[model samples]
Target: MNFADISSDIRHNQIIELLLQNNNLSAAKIAAILNISSRSVEKHLAKLKQDKIIIRQGSKKYGT
Candidate 1:
């Protein structure tokens, strides 16, 4: 369950970089930036969360 496994993934790395640039970026925004679907972004985000690599800070609509 080490994050290092997926951390090396291109999409995962890009997501992390985007978050570092602006922590408030939403999944949809990330998706648009990456030219991927929102669902795909959500899936990646969910896995990141499950791995404890990231955390959702507040409400879904207005949270970072």
Candidate 2:
């Protein structure tokens, strides 16, 4: 894979690991933890959701 693809995969895995540790994290919180932008975190979250890797439990502001 290209470097960018590998990097994205690594970040995706990290995001999953973080979620496993604390499922209540917000996109902003994940962005801060990953040293990435909130927009990027949101994109990652979208991909995870699309792939059925994760699921939202409630409202965006207070979901787990």
Candidate 3:
């Protein structure tokens, strides 16, 4: 299932850019910035994970 079928490759690439911007921000963070739902962020992340495009780093608490 290529993202090109449902979403734009450039948009996904932008998501990748965000992930790489700072060790992969949380899905919540991305959604907040993009004005989307966390579930949507998760969806994008899942696709990225499946493609081995981004990775998960250590987690940090919110507002800590």
Candidate 4:
């Protein structure tokens, strides 16, 4: 795999780990914790949701 792919995987894994520890974290919060952009965090979260790796439980504001 390319370096970018590996890096994305690492970030994805980090997001997953963080979620496991605290599912209530927001995308902005995750972005801050990961030292990345909120847009990037949103993209990663979209991917995880698309893959069924994570699912939203309620409305955007109240979901986990």
lDDT values of the candidates?
0.88, 0.93, 0.72, 0.96
- Candidate 2, 12: how far from true, in Å? 0.5
- Tell me the tens digit of each residue's lDDT in model 4 across 2-55: 999999899999999999999999999999999999999999999999999999
The most accurate candidate by lDDT is 4
lDDT of 1 at 37: 96
Rank candidates by lDDT, best first. Answer: 4, 2, 1, 3
Model 4 stretches astray by more than 4 angstroms: none
lDDT of 3 by residue, 1-64 (tens): 6867656566577678776686547777888887888997778877877888865555445421
Query: Over the stretch 4-29, how does candidate 2's per-residue lDDT look in tens digits?
Result: 98988899999999999999888999
Q: Count the backbone clashes (under 3 Å) in each candidate.
A: 0, 0, 0, 0
Question: What is candidate 3's local distance difference test score?
Answer: 0.72
Error of 4 at 57 (Å): 0.7
TM-scores for the candidates: 0.81, 0.90, 0.68, 0.94
Return the clash pairs for model 4, or none.
none
Q: Judge candidate 1 against the unseen true structure and give its global Cα lDDT, from 0 to 1.
A: 0.88
TM-score of 4: 0.94
lDDT of 1 by residue, 1-64 (tens): 5676555477888998999999999888999999999998988898889999999988978888
